[model samples]
Target: MTTRAFCLEPEQLDWCARLRTLAAERFRPLAEHGADGRLNRPLLAALGTERGLLDRVFPPDGTAASALDLCLLRESLAHGCTEAETALALQGLGGSPLAQFGTAGQRERWLPGIAGGRTVVGFALSEPGAGSDAAALELAATPDGGGGWRLTGTKTWISNAPYADVYTVFARTGEAAGARGVTAFLVPGDRAGLTGEPLEMLSPHPIGTLRFDEVPVTAADVLGEPGAGFGVAMRTLNLFRPSVGAFAVGMAQSALEAALAHADRRTAFGGRLRDMQSVAHQLAEMATRTEAARLLVHAAAAAYDRGDDGIARRAAMAKLLATETAQYVVDTAVQIHGATALQRGHPLEHLYREVRAPRIYEGATEVQRSIIAKELYR
Candidate 1:
């Protein structure tokens, strides 16, 4: 039997050990319940507020956490609860810019609730026409005469849009037409004319589209400089992209575990599945790819923590490799499990669906390739 090896520093290993215990004790039950279409929001809220997991990676002090710490927590949480992983990840993503650049008042108003799980936060950048070409967004934010802004446009494929209390929304600030015109706003979900509708996905979560018909915002809500929305969004992605890889690593780890457990117990050709050279080779390959992906994710996280400008490139690399590798690993696990993997409620089956979205989100594989090419040529 191949025992999964975690590649983490000693301190991160300790943190992961604690996080795993918490996941087993708390999140696992919720995850099992959620499997039957029961999403326990109150339970998640309690975990965030009472258990203190939301603040694990994003501390109150604004000091950067080690990349290993972030990866450890993400992987551990994802192992037991992907919805909780999604919720926690969005908190980090939504509040990250504020942590990086918000005025004290802005941070005071939002960060605590986020850390306490009193509210949900979302990032709204993609539009009907602007996904991979993110800079081509057409959402307009015109300055209102009363010293505020009136946002008008539609954003699609927004994560957490259906339940978010606040959104880090992006829109056009200039007529130049491209990345230059983009600006970001901290739009309250309850603001007038701001509405969202849930989007059904292959793997379910609180994803949706956000519509703004003159949604209002004060200058106080602008995330950074008016023309710096693209930078903020990209910088935020650079910081969290490795964690996406970490999510993939976690899913892959679960799949590998399921496969190995099945292999050890299921007999075939007068021996256990683990005795077959073909199955052992496949398991070896899956393990190798998963570990390699973890290394890439950690290296990118470490680079960001060290304040290295190379983080964007490394993050893109990690996101690309880890998500694709996760797809491969999960598919192999499904094959190893044979008919059992196809059963609707199987853990491997769930992982199969969960692993598909990471490649599409965070910036698709093609976008990452372009990013790598551009960086290499530059």
Candidate 2:
């Protein structure tokens, strides 16, 4: 199985090469089955644990990784398996707050299970009214008499919610509305008064709304300082946003490959589809945009890896460009395939849906543009 080559540093390139081999050997066979929407919980857990894919990229020991290396791993995984990619990404994001600010006991209790894939994790920060405007979260977490807290309200569009054992959830802790008053908590799935219902969507992933009604949480669940949930969320987003772009890069790369393959073999007007100037131009545009997006994504990752203070703005730009460009590239690939791309089980169709979610999650493209503009003006 020949894998695509990405321009990266020697170590980064080697890591990606190994990742591709692993994905081909393990994740490829599982991708389609996982996409069936039956929620293959045990299979996903076993795969993640056996391969150590989750632990390798996101170690709990505070070991630092290059942004480029992180992007390479994610991009490779996404190219071969969106389900695996989704699984790994959620683990990292869901557990990141704990890694970043949890008490030692909290980290010890949760990190090992997540690393071993024995437990799944989720981040539930998006509320019905707080998708892009995270500061508008209405869920309340008031202190209970026994030094614990009672949580009330709902979180919608939560990824990996149905299958996750734990979630890093945010709720209001202060009277000052918006970002300043929010606090983060680690909510275990089996806790009483907490319920989740799976949401069906165009894409096949475990997403749902979580309703918390007088759900009790101990002080140990608090992540970071009180009233610091917004910042913690922002910090996590800064790190993971580039991976979202990497996902786009992977999708676009797949689309370009499909387009090129079809253009070479499909006959049209007494010659190959590639012979047509229109087809050739479209392919060229797709390749160019894909490469450009790749560069931006990696560049942002590199900047973050270097601990650059300007990483937020750079990451936002990368996420914005890569996601929007991926949408275009995949749409063009579908166009080039004509009717074949529309088939229900075609890879292109899956890529189409997979490419869209990145645009809306993390931060919408419009939200990214605003962040970029704000940083530029500042």
Candidate 3:
């Protein structure tokens, strides 16, 4: 496989390095200036206008980007500026359905602003009752007398909620049960009866809950066929799952680099930390596991790009291993660095908080395991 070739092409490596530089030089400053737990509009604008990274995800040609490209972009951005990485990821996640399954009018209406970073979007799939079990969503989309539907329910843990200019919402359209009754809608944030409030989270990125008090949606707002929203959601997830792994790998790589730098400098026992056999071995393990996770992420992304069979299994494996590896890598780095790593503004401290969530969100670690097992049986 291309990913197994032992190294990314020279050009690809250069591209990743360039992206990392941009993340540090451009994105990080914007993130630092923004308030915690709030959507950073300036950072979004920088990604869209300055770097045009969002355009890579939602191309104007109405075609989906290769999963490998998404993976590389995410991993590189995440290596330097996680906030920037997140902003880009959320935009891609929310806009993917529109690019893939939306009507002409829908695409024409929304894609431009999304690409330019003037508009923010949210993926409103998770609810209190049905988060990991997405098909069991209860956001009711009842038929109105005028061929439209009225949405009434709550969406929790939504990224960019309450502030996004638009949302891609999946609701129960009652065509059938469990993965069949769902339908996706393109909801304008300013629409009446739809409101949201931010929730306090461990990570600084924006997240909140949305309340739909009979928000009205027209037939024009529906994405793809009625009752096919589950497929739409799954397709989106398949493309992104590996990239989520890439995000983890980026964080892992960052932590590994930090550990290496710290080990090289911090002296203990009359020598540098890196000089100790125990510390040296720990660094080696962190490097090995991080490399393994990176390989898994790249392989899954390549498989997805090729439309290979067992993509679900591969993606699940990548996400599971990489997220778990990131957690271990970050935690170990903190241990090696000791109490100084726990200081409020320490990079490791920020990473420690950030690392825990990837294992929980976008299909938790347990959920990924279930998916892999199910695919293997199939």
Candidate 3 wrong stretches, greater than 4 Å = 1-6
For every candidate structure, what is the RMSD over all alpha carbons to the true structure, in angstroms? 3.6, 3.8, 1.5
The candidate maximizing lDDT is 3
State residue 289's C-alpha deviation in candidate 3, in Å: 0.6
Ranking by TM-score: 3, 2, 1
lDDT of 3 by residue, 129-179 (tens): 999999889999999999999999999999998799999999999999889
lDDT at 24 for candidate 3?
91
Q: Give, for candidate 3, the lowest lDDT window spanning 10 residues.
A: 1-10
Estimated TM-score per prediction?
0.94, 0.94, 0.98
lDDT, model 2, position 44: 60
Q: What is the per-residue lDDT of model 2 for residues 186-303, given as tens digits with 9 covering 90 to 100?
A: 9999889999888887667778889999999877888998788999999999988998999889889888998999999999889999999999999999999989989999889888
* CA RMSD (A), model 1: 3.6
- List the candidate 1 regions with Cα displacement exceeding 4 Å: 1-7, 34-40
The lDDT for every candidate, in the order shown, is 0.82, 0.84, 0.93
Error of 1 at 33 (Å): 3.4
Error of 3 at 318 (Å): 0.7
